[model samples]
Each structure stands twice: as C-alpha cells, then as structure tokens.
Target: MNKLSLTRRAFVTSASAFGLVGASGLALPYYSRANQRPAFTHGVQSGDVDATSGMVWTRTDRPARVMYEVSTTESFADAVRLAPLDTSPASDYTVKRLLTDLAADQDIFYRMTAADLSDINAVSEPIVGRFRTAPASKRDVRFAWSGDTAGQGWGIDETGMKIYSTIAKHTPDFFLHSGDTIYADGAMKDEVDLPGGGKWKNVVMIDGKRKVAETLDEYRDQWKYNMMDKHVLALSAICPTFYQWDDHEVVNNWSDSKDLTTDNRYTEKSIPVLAARAARAFHE
Candidate 1:
C-alpha cells in the first residue's frame, strides 16, 4: 500500500468523509454510506497485548484489502505502516494481525482504512483505536473483566449496557472476557416485566437473539447483536479485549455427554454440529 499522503485530521474532518464528525465534534454510528463504499461494519478492537505486541481487529462490509499504520502519536506524525491484508468470505470479511516491535509502556495508536477489492480505488473512511503496551519494567497495571452479556433475556435497553461504559471510564489497559462472550442460546423477547411496576425493554430486537442459534449465520448475528449496543462499541474502540468462552456460547450446560433431542428449539439436533457452528462464529 502507498503511504497515506493525507493526514488523519485532514481525512476525518473532510466534508466528504461520510460525516465522521459533525459540528458537535462527535461521530455517528452506522454513518450513512449511500454511495455503497466499503465500510468498517463494527468498531475497531485490540487485544492479547504484551510488552511489545498486541492484536488489532476489524471487519469490512465486503471483500477488501485493509491497510493499517501504528503510531505513538494520535496525529500519526511518526506512523509505521504494515503490509495490507485482504478480507474474504472465508473469514467473514474480518481481519486481524499481531503488531510486533512496539515500544513498551507507551500509547499505541492504530489506524485502518479499507479499499474494496472489487473497486480498489474506492476506499473507506479511516478508523482509529488506541492501546497501551505493557511496561518493560516494574510498574502499575490496570484492567477489567466481564461475562454473561445479554443473558436471560436481559438485552440492551434504551439505557444501553451501562456496565461497559462504567468499565471504559477507568480506561483499563485491556479487558478479559471471561466467558459467555455471546449468549447465543438465550433467546430474548421484546420486553420482560419486572417483579415490580417497571418494564425491562429491549431497545432493538434482532432476529438472531429472538431464538436459539442453530445455523452459522445465525450464530454470527448473535455476536453482531451484542456489539450493536452503544456502550459495548465505545469500550471496544479503545480497550483491547481477550476472549474466552463458556457453555452459553453454544448452549446452556453444553457438554460432550449432552443431548439436544429433547430440545426442539434447534432444527439441528446434534450438539457437536451446533457447537461447530457456534465455535466458528465465536472465533470470528
């Protein structure tokens, strides 16, 4: 990929930059791309960070070659560009890489821009995320961990997942997702009445979360639905997350000895087959 001649500020602030920023200096989610240019579907993510390396990830709307650069400064005055990577149907258009040779105990800013493989000249608006590499010497370290998201019909509501926003407030170096990265087996209704007079409502109802996941695409949608929450997206943008899974990633109390014959919610009655599809979505 050619070195980006345009500065980050000039690129994002440009009038044709797809309204990445408005007069309020804040950006909009799912910013309209009526022109159908390739887009970064989900927000950027980083994880598995160490003293000198970290993993950065993102996904595109279509097959594209994503180019990225790393810098110690947000302005990218001293950026280190890496070889571009191509996203395809096999990987669900998601791309991630391990960034090595980074300075320890320093802020690392990573930026990504994708060019549609079908239309190489049509590029995407650049997206940026930051993470601090581990310290080379003895020093203080901070982090966060979470699990069981949108479980038991407690989906994202109008207030959003406030816990994620609370966790981001501390600006942890990274986050550990202990398990249940997604509640694929927990089908959520539009709303559930509380024990008292209040109502717990799902601000957005996705078809994937409406039933237990059985197909590969449905499992993928389960993950996407969780990221739809504003708080979840905000935390992921700047904080790296190391993921682990639990039974809920496939089904409640799932195991080799488990049987799905009694459960008719899934058309695929084989637990192994269901687990395979869920595993692929989780990995992606």
Candidate 2:
C-alpha cells in the first residue's frame, strides 16, 4: 500500500464534509458503544468530487490508523488499498482523505477499516460508500442542497429525518448543505406538546442535546446528534455533503457584534471567544 503524505492544511480543508458503524455494529449514538477494538463510529462519506478526484471521511471511537481502498465495483474485488492515516485526540479521532487519479464519470466504491493504534490486531470490520466522479465531457449533472437540520427543538424521532431519504431518491451527485447545519443554541426537550392532541417525542436525547451548546464538546454533539439519524447516515454514505455554516453553528444571529449579555446559559459571554470555539467545532 502506498501512503499519501498529508499536510495539516489538507486536513483542515477536508473537514467541511464529513460517516457509519463497523466492527461494533452497535448502530449510532456511538457515545454509549465502547469496546477495546476500534470502530468506525460514524459511517463513511465521499464528496468534493471532480473529474479525477474526491474527498472521503470517517470517524472512529478512539485513536487508530484508518485504511482506505477504492473500487469501481461494490463487491470490492478490485479494490486498491491505500496506506493508513493516523487519527488521535487532536482531531477528535476524525479524519478525511482526498483521493485522486480516479476515472472520470464512473461509479466509485470506497471501503474503510480501522486498526487501533494501540492494538493492531483489534481491527474493525469494513464500511463502504459509493460516489461518481465528474464527467470529463458535457453531460447532465444533478445535485441536491438543503440546510437547517435538527433545529428549533425538532430532532430525530421514530420517523428519522425522512426528508434525507427523499433527497437520496434523486441520486444526486452530491449535496450542498447551505448552512445552519446544527442549531447549537437551540436546546431540545425529550418531548414536545403537539396542538393536535399528540406528543412529538424525541426518542433519543443525549445530555448534550438537552440544553444550549456552550462547550466545544457540546457544539460537536450537535453534529453527532444529527448523524445519529438513519436517513442522514444513508445519504452521507452514498452522497458527499459539502457543509457550510450559518450563525447557528456558533449562536443565533452570530456576528462580530453579537450579544450574549442577556443570555444566561453561557458562562463565557465573549462573542469573539464563543465564535472561535464554534468555528473549530464546525471545521471538525
């Protein structure tokens, strides 16, 4: 396997687009799922595709060396293995790699595995994703775009982000998330009263989602909670999502002049400081 020498700049550039379960097979809310073996806690994703290149991303439960392979077929019989990339606490155990020299306008199957840095034998079961590269010549191209996910206290319920599945039905080349990807300031309750004599239940509510995000980990949780949805995970695996951020990624109506004096949930009221924290979480 040939290792690609990655620069810090490259990793920062790829963090905007970000995956599924492997080995543990415990599904999502990976926070509760722990074991000695490394697991692909989040699924795999591919995006930022061009005629001959694209980006792929995934996250693990702990420090590990993530390996990669790409195939034109789903069975992966002709998979070309690439050298592993080490991930650690520095990146919160998340990593993305840019793949180049791919054939234009073709179906690409990517497979990934993780070997615990501390125990190489404790490797993970593979996870896979599919994407198509841009065409070299003129052709019909399709893509989807949307934003404002898991916001306004509405969260993943039993229905599980049905709209994402609807988007995947079109089989777009990629997805553009326009912004407000996570409502970090919007707190959630386990249940919301409905006007129609029923209750909107948030079946899985983590502590991070219970209140407004103030800490860096809390902000990160906002993204993690959205990915816990099956539909989001499904779309992510098959289509690359290019992410953008709005004020919500930091705080509501965030700006250099934004105010937090009236808000009591935050102990640190400095907009500059808070926005800086949010920016890091957004990049990751």
Candidate 3:
C-alpha cells in the first residue's frame, strides 16, 4: 500500500482496536450486534473531498468485513482497491474509509462489498457511489446548502426527502449540510396541528417519536431513521458533502451554560453532560 493508504488504514485499525479514549481515562464502547449475514441497509455516502482525498461512508446490518474499490472509469478496469476494514457494534455497524492520492479535478466512481461472517460464502451486492475531487489549482465550483430535516413535525415520508432530490437535480459538485442534519432534540408527531387550523401528516416509525433523545442508542437511532429516506440516500450517492452541526442535533440552541430543566423534553438536567454525549454521537 502507498503511504496515504497506509496512514488511512492505520488510523481506522487503531481506532477499532483501542476505542475512543478520554482525558478521564474512560473508554467509549464500540457498537456491536449478534452474528448475521451482512446487508447494506442504508446505502452509501461520499464527502469531505480535496485535491487528492475523500471519505466514503456506509452501514451494514450485521458484523462484516467492508471492502471498497475506486476508479475513474465506470467499469473500474483500473480500480484501486483500498485495504479491507471491519464494522462492529461499537460503530453501530458503520464504516468510513478514506480514499487518498486521487487525481485532482476528476470524477471518481466507488463501490463497497461486505463479506458476511455468519456464512463464509455470503457476500452483499455492491453499493455504488460517485464523487468529484477538488481542483489542484483554483477553479470555479458549484454547490448547494440546506438543513433541518424531519423538523417542525414534518417527518420523512414515502416521497423521500423531495427537497434533496430537487437540489440533486442541479448536479452541484457537493452539498453543505448546514446543521440540524437531524432533530434528535425535536419530536415528530404522527399528526401535527397546523397554524391555520389544518393537520400535517407524518410517517411515524416508532412510538417514542415525540420524545427527546436521552440515551446513546436513541441518538444513534435518530440518525439511522433519517437515512431511511430514499431521496436523501440518492442525493448522497452522487454529491460529496461538508457537514456542520446545529443546536437541534442536541437541543434547541443548547450551549454549555444552557439550562435543561426549563425544557420539559429534557430528562437530563445537566447540559454539560448531555452536550458531551451529544458531541460523541455527532462525531461517530
């Protein structure tokens, strides 16, 4: 492997092996699941592109070894295969592989393969995606920005995040998700009362859809639920993304000094403690 590839692989390997260590000497647990055939439930996403590198992300329904191949050609005749990586419960079966040493100002096609351990011969159908590298030299670029998904009682519907599809139609080089990527702090009711005396329908997935996220699992589930939108998945497959976080990701306008006791939705009164957990989930 080249130095870039080696560096990427080493970082992931070490992280998987040691977990996230904190100043207080506490180690964050890695997510894991019972053995089963691997399945790509959430599709794929590419983001954080530069002249020579980018990040690809995916999630598997079970524990498995994730492999990725990238190429400039659609057929992948001259593809570069990265080192294989593993997914466990620690990451909630998510895998993010970094691709490096890529040509600048070029379109790249990539695909992922998961080898299911429950059955040694079982392998998943490839999940394909594409992205463009940033230009080595200064050049004009086009991109789009949006945020606040499943917010204000408007949850994901079968139509699948239609706004994202509309944005994708413009074919921007990338997308800037400006915060509120998820409303882990907001509740989505099955039927929401409108300001003008009408009802807005929402496709509810769970009973606690109206509760604020308190546990780590709840926060993770909020993300997983948002990915269920097909349009969102479709947009991600083609557009690289630069993601930023906003208050709704934890609580509305939450800060280290904010008081949670005033908010009935928050069961945890400690803003600092909740912020720490929220930050952890956001990074993962």
Candidate 4:
C-alpha cells in the first residue's frame, strides 16, 4: 500500500481544488455538474505505494481521456505530466494510474483531468490528491486499520461515517481496511427485527442496498453507494488505504467447501459461479 503524510493546509487546499468545498468552507459530499460534463464522482484515491512509486485512482461520469499529473509541490509548479489514459465502459469509467520513479519519503501532490473524447479542449475541473512514499531507510511509521462500512442493516448516513473524519484528523501514513467494506450479499431494509420486539431503523433507498448484488453492475453499485458518504471521500483524499475482502463481500461465512443450498437466502445454488462473478467485481 502507498503511504501518505498530509499537512492540514494541503488537505484543505486539495479539497478546494476538487470543488468539494461549499459556501461554509467545509467539504460537501455532492456537487452539481457543469453543462453535464464528465466529473470525478467518487473523488480521488491513492494506494499500493512503495518507496519509489504509488498508484492513483479515480472515476469519470463518461468516456474520456483521464490524465494523471504529479508534482513535488502542492502548487503544481513544474509538474510532470504523464500520458493521458482512455477510460471506457469496459472499466466502469474508472482509471488507475501507476506513478513510478518517485523519491523516497517525500510528499507527492497529484491531480487528474478528464477531457471529452470528441473535443479534447473540453476538460473537466481538476481533482487533486496527495500521497507520500515510504522511507528508504528504517523509520518508525504509524497507521490505522478497520472495516465494515455500510454493513448489516445499517447503511451510510450523513453523520454515520464520522469515524473516518476522526481517522483523517490523525493523518496516518496509511490505513488498512481489514474486511467487510460492503455487504453485497446482505439486503438492507428500512428497519430490521430486534430481540425485544423492537426495530432497528436504517437509512434506506440507497442504490443496491435493498437487494442482493447478483449481477456485476449490482456489485459495483455496492461500492459506489459507500463513496457517497462525505466522510469516506474526505478520508480517501487525505489518507492512502489498503483494502482486503471478507465473506460479506460475497456472502456471510462463504467458503469453497460450503454448500450454497444450505443458505435459504441465496436464490442461485451454484457457489462456484457466484464466487467467480464476485471475484471479478472485487478485483475491479
């Protein structure tokens, strides 16, 4: 995973550059599109960072040329522009760029620009992000790890992911997502039954939340739903993350030896076929 060390000022500036700031000087989750232009809906992220290089990722609304630019300074002076990569429907409009030949233990500022395929001159607003390379020498490093976002019957809310905001405040070098990033096999409801004849209320109507993710598109939507949270977006901008998957990404306590017929919740009895489809979505 890539490591990142961000100053509070740089974080704020980066958020501003992405047009994430509202009138209150606080980062907002959603933004209006300009003339229906391609926009970075999921924000920017970096990961798989090492001493000499790192990976950056982002998604656009439409097919376009996604350009990756890197700079030593946050101002982007004398920035090195890399070749623009084409994003198509094949990759769900997502692009991952590998930045190489980087300096060790140095803060790196990166940004992305999307240009319309038909008109190269029509470029979207830049989305800025940051990351730091691991030190070449032995050094003490600090990081955090956790998981289970938008899981169970509890879906993401405006304030539910405040833990991510708390995590961002510490400015950890990197974060490890232990598991259960999304419960693709679990169906969400407005309320769930409790032991004492009570109810567990949940925020509902989220895309792909009400039903199981059977198709690849459904599986992808499970991820997109979590990105809608501002806290997740903010944490991603400031902290690099390494992700791992758990059974919930496919099904609860799923294993190669387990029988699909045992689970009444699953309509498809073929575990191998379901696992194959789930793996493709997970890797993507």
TM-score of each: 0.84, 0.83, 0.82, 0.81
If both were scored by lDDT, which would come out higher, candidate 2 or candidate 4? 2
Of the two candidates 3 and 4, the one with more favorable TM-score, higher being better, is 3
lDDT of 2 by residue, 71-189 (tens): 78787876666657889888778898888777788888888878777666566778899898888999998999999998877897988899999999999988999999988888899
Q: Per-residue CA lDDT of candidate 3, range 1-284, in tens?
A: 21222234423333222223445666554343434446898888888898888999999988888877777877887566666778888988888987877778888889887876454345677889999888878888999998888887788655657988898899899999999987877767778788979776777465435677777777887787777888888899999988898898888877546776667656455566666777776766
Q: Candidate 3 clashing pairs?
A: 30-90, 31-89, 31-90, 32-89, 32-90
**How would you encode candidate 4's per-residue C-alpha lDDT over 14-89 as one tens digit per residue?**
4344333467987554333577467888998889998888889898988888876677788888466666778888
Q: Per-residue lDDT of 104-199 in model 1, one digit per residue for the tens?
A: 788888999887777665678899999988888997789999898888999988899999999999999889999998888888999899997888
Q: In model 3, which range of ten residues has the least summed lDDT? A: 1-10
Best model number under TM-score: 1
Error of 3 at 108 (Å): 1.2
- Order of models, best TM-score first: 1, 2, 3, 4
Off by over 4 Å in 4: 1-33, 192-205, 256-259, 264-269
Flag clash pairs in model 4. Answer: 1-49, 2-49
Candidates ranked by lDDT: 1, 2, 4, 3
TM-score computed on alpha carbons, candidate 3? 0.82
Screening candidate 1 with a backbone cut-off below 3 angstroms (N, C-alpha, C), the clashing residue pairs are none
- Those runs of model 3 whose alpha carbons end farther than 4 Å from true positions after fitting are 1-37, 204-208, 256-259, 264-269
